[model samples]
Target: MVNDMDNIAGTLQQSLIQIITSVLTVIGVFILMLTISWKLTIIALVTIPLSILVVAFVAPTSQRLFGRQQAALGKINDQVEETYAAHTIVRTFNKEEDEEKEFNRRNHQYYQSAWKAQFFSSLMMPMMIFIRNVGYLVVAVVGAIQVIHGQITLGNVQAFLQYTNQFSQPIAQIANLSNTIQQTIASAERIFEVLDEPEMDDKIKETPVLAGKNLPKVEFKDIQFSYTDEPLIQDFNLKAPRDKMVAIVGPTSAGKTTIINLLERFYDPQGGHVYLDGQDIGSMTRDDLRKHIAIVLQDTWLFTGTIFENIKYGNENASDEEVYHAAKMARADAFIRELPDGYQTVPDESASNISQGQRQLLTIARAFLADPEILILDEATSSVDTRTEVLIQEAMNALQQERTSFVVAHRLSTIRKADQIVVVNHGKIIETGNHESLMNQKGFYAALYNSQFAGN
Candidate 1:
């Protein structure tokens, strides 16, 4: 998508000047031909209509093929990216041949579209050349007869013939540029499609309602949402009291992460409002809402940058000392310092140089440094060792002090002490209470909790 847009931009920029020069040249040469002999000038004009018809015939087909070509290229890029990004999984599963075959399929699709688009675009120049030559032949034969009848001079006829070629030259130049114009149009359509999408409302409401003194720090009010036509999280309501830890535990696809996504305003509920400090989150700018919240996701993402820089991304204005302190709090400083470059260590593109647990720790440190009023940890300790989990839990316990926290955990053991343990299935909360209370009730939460320790 990006490369195609760049090519479109370059084509447009170059085409603008070429098109203008060609038009002016055509106009100037036409006047000269008229001055030499109006009869020959009229003969030359016949090619203009023919050139228009050729473009009319070919432009749509060329544009359509180019669109398909760009689409195929996008698929190829996606396949290559997905393959390389998951190369480890592919090798482990012995599915390298499957991946290669998929890549070849996408590559072949690209080849098919590209050749057809090129073929149609290439036809424009030859067709224009053919029309120009026919016009030249007609003008020459007529000019010869007129010169012999003494109605027009041989010198004038010769000059008119030369002018005819000049006129045809610019026309052919413009015809060749039709291919580029078609490509640009195709690329521009893709770009514009994105640009034309309805923008999210960033307007902050005046007279914003403040959270009631007794209200929860974060609340989902009668929320209704769905990823598809099937309803999910219908009439879902939850509240996290100020300065409390709320743990959401569920099986896979139980909409645990979806709850976090809602709280962070990643997706607005289709049917209800989310409140922050009693104010409708929809009324606040996304930046404002996000500033008060920080999330550490299951997947650790580290760009190609120094360890210190990645941590400081949490708070760009944070001092070096503050960054180091945050890392220590998240239990990431020890591993970071042991590295060859210490804080200056630049992780590779995938950040595979460091261990997965280290990457998660760094993300934790980043969230800690944000010092947000609301902290979200989605499987933050999933990648860490048992010992590292203990240290991170301790740091998180301290970090959650006097701040609202949401922890999405798969391991039942992790949220034993949470103020509120919400057991979710599908999307609705099936059980809500402290772990001790739920275990005593011997409900779904108790069964799920007990199953984990069944072997032990």
Candidate 2:
């Protein structure tokens, strides 16, 4: 996208002036040629059609090749980004050679498309020059014949030839511009495709009435959703009361995260509705809805900034004192203060400067700063050690005091104390009860939970 934008910008800045200049020069020279010798002017004008033919033949091919080149360039960018981001994993798995081979393949694809595009575009200028020279030779011969027959003065014939040369100069200039024009069109096509895509639905208005005495903090009603054409979740319904911790657990591909995604409005259900505080979530603007929720994912995201800035990202208006307090609550303050620059320490681009657990702690601190009405922890403690996990669990218990919390966890021990344990399998809720009740029932949840500790 960046490369394409640069191409578009350059074309607009330079080609606009060149086009205007060429058009005016072509018109001015054509009139001069006609006034000097109309007969010779006719001969000069004949070559214009041939020049047009050359451009017609080459310009479309150049555009298509440039489009292919841009697509290949995009693939190269993706390859480099993925390879570097997963550099440690690749080295650990001894797959460096595989990564290098993939990168080389993408690079070669880019080279192939780029070479063809440039070669075709470069053909236009020389082709135009050849056609113009042919017209020049014919015009010169005819002009001399007119001069010999006393039909025109030698000076006039000479001036007409000069005018013919001037006329073809602009034509050649426009022909040369065809290359840049084709590239710009290819770039603009890509940009416009993105710009013209349908925007996410933001049609909801009017705050939902939360006047009911005991409305659920979050509720999903007869929900149906799927990432693909096949249904993944169907007829899913849940009512999570305010100030309660709801734990969702199941085997892999059990649509555990899909439930959270629906509540977060990341993907709206194809059917039914999600309500927050008695108002249909779909009837609320995403910004308005998201302001009430905070989520910490398994993969922590932090930019290259100080610990203070990273925590303050959740609430930009938060004071330095608030950031410090949030970090302390998340148990991140002690380690952060021990660092060389404490809160001022800048993390690397990938935040690899800090341990994985520390990165997770920073994200939790960020969530604390958000102070949202709802909290979501999706495998948030997965990266930490047992000791760190206990600290996080303690911090989370404190953070979940008043807010409704949803914990998607694989370690059943972490969510054993949840107010509600919802076991899902193949998208349907198979069991709903507290840990004690579910364990006593000896259902799927009990079997799954007991299996974890069976070996331990």
Candidate whose TM-score is highest: 1
Worst 10 residues of 1 by lDDT: 203-212
Worst 10 residues of 2 by lDDT: 203-212
What shift in Å separates residue 434 of candidate 1 from its native position after superposition? Answer: 1.1
Report residue 181 deviation for candidate 1 (angstroms): 3.1
- Model 2, runs deviating above 4 Å: 13-17, 27-43, 100-108, 149-151, 205-212
lDDT against true structure, model 1: 0.88
Q: Give lDDT tens digits, candidate 1, residues 229-255.
A: 998787788999999999999889989
Candidates in order, TM-scores: namely 0.92, 0.90
Instruction: Tell me the whole-model lDDT of each prediction, alpha carbons only.
Output: 0.88, 0.90
152-174 per-residue lDDT for model 2 (tens digits)? 88898778878888899899999
